[model samples]
Target: MLTYEEIMLLITALASVFSVIAVYYAIIEKNLVRAVVFSAIQSTIYAFIYYMFMAPDIVLVYIPVAVGLYPAVILILISKTEKVEKQ
Candidate 1:
């Protein structure tokens, strides 16, 4: 059976992988909306990783900053940008 630490480590690894993938997609995606969504996904993974590390306070702080405010800000920014032209 896996220990708590081992399980947390595994979860953290998975979250890290997700974060990397999200960042890659965000950078490569042409659509502003898709990039914003990817960035939000990355933030969520980061928050999960922080929770796995047993930093609940960090999770608490990160949740609002990452999952809440950041996405709203990104949405606002994307709304301000001109429409994307499809290739």
Candidate 2:
């Protein structure tokens, strides 16, 4: 079995990679819906990293706020906005 530190390191690395990908996707994606999805993915990875650090309480609180509420709010805002022409 992997050591705790090793597992934490791996989770942190994965979180970093996910964050970078999310930023890149947000910049490149013209569609608001796609950007919101990418942001949600990044939030989920961050919650995983928090869990790996033995912060279950933080994960519990953050998952709903970040993964659930944030995405829902973004979707609502996006739905209200007028569609823009594709560049």
Judging by TM-score against the true structure, name the best candidate.
Answer: 1
What does candidate 2's lDDT look like per residue over 1-87, in tens digits? 999888779879978887888879966888878888898988888888888778999999999999999999978987898444278
Give Cα-based local distance difference scores for all models: 0.86, 0.85
- Which ranges of candidate 2 are over 4 A from the true structure? 1-4, 85-87
Q: Note the residue pairs that clash in candidate 2.
A: none
Clashing pairs in 1: none
lDDT of 1 by residue, 1-87 (tens): 999888878878988988999999988888878888899899888888887777999999999998899889878877888545366
Tell me the TM-score of model 2: 0.81
Estimate the overall C-alpha local distance difference test score of candidate 2.
Answer: 0.85
Best by lDDT: 1
TM-score of each: 0.86, 0.81
